[model samples]
Target: MFKLGLLIILAAIVVCAQSIPFLEESNTVAECLASNNITQAEFQELIERSSEEDDLENTERRYKCFVHCLAKKGNLLDSNGYLDVEKIDQIEPLTEDLREVLYDCKKMHDDEQYLCEYAFKMVTCLTDNLEQSDEVTEAEKNTNKLNE
Candidate 1:
């Protein structure tokens, strides 16, 4: 009876975790792109540009608007163009550290004017913070192994 109960609980956890939606749903992405009148090639170019560290500072308005569209679709942005941290906290598969980083980034960009710019800044900030966090984590693990 104990083993059966444990198995059932584990199975339920797996099912719940699997059901958690990805931050961007495919249908939502398509809808947002269509609404924004963005072609896949243009979107790909934006993605490539955003990936380049130096290009982030010069993101085009169209790219920023597309980001805003995605955030709006996901209900991640509040009425004032700021990130709704509460909504962000509910996204599953996000580590506690990542959540903390997100909250910090939201506060950091709290005064952004336009919805498009706010969304774009938040995305960039989160990406940079997460990358830094991963580097720090990796360094810590290496140090611990060395000490061991």
Candidate 2:
């Protein structure tokens, strides 16, 4: 019984170790940007412009345009009310990177008895970025200014 418990613990450790790499790579791109570990020149430009704009609504429109431009460059499209894509082509080469990371993470989970940490990190990173955009920030500012 002790040996069985030890084996289970060891299996869990191995799974966690393997998943670390997958989460590291897959979550790096967006997490870094959101955390400012990755410098986002495009987002900066939009944010700066939004800062200068007189009207929040117009600022938001421009910010949305900037996001659409970025998405075009990234070859990504709106999917499943989320980030879903009909084909990998929508994301260009980065699609392959995402796929590779996801596969590695899932392989680790299935063979090494890991859990879906990568999926959690990936979703969190994406959501964080989506929420931190200039439009959202400006909207918040507008709300605060109105309340005051």
Winner by lDDT = 1
* Residue-wise C-alpha lDDT for candidate 1, range 23-100, written one tens digit per residue: 324476567667778777776554454433344555457656766766676666567766676665565555677668
Which candidate has the top score in TM-score? 1
State the C-alpha lDDT per candidate: 0.59, 0.35
Candidate 2 residues 52-81, lDDT tens each? Answer: 443422222333333322233232323321
Displacement of the residue 7 alpha carbon in candidate 2, Å: 45
What lDDT does model 1 reach? 0.59
After TM-score superposition, the amount by which residue 30's alpha carbon in candidate 1 deviates from its true location, in angstroms, is 1.6
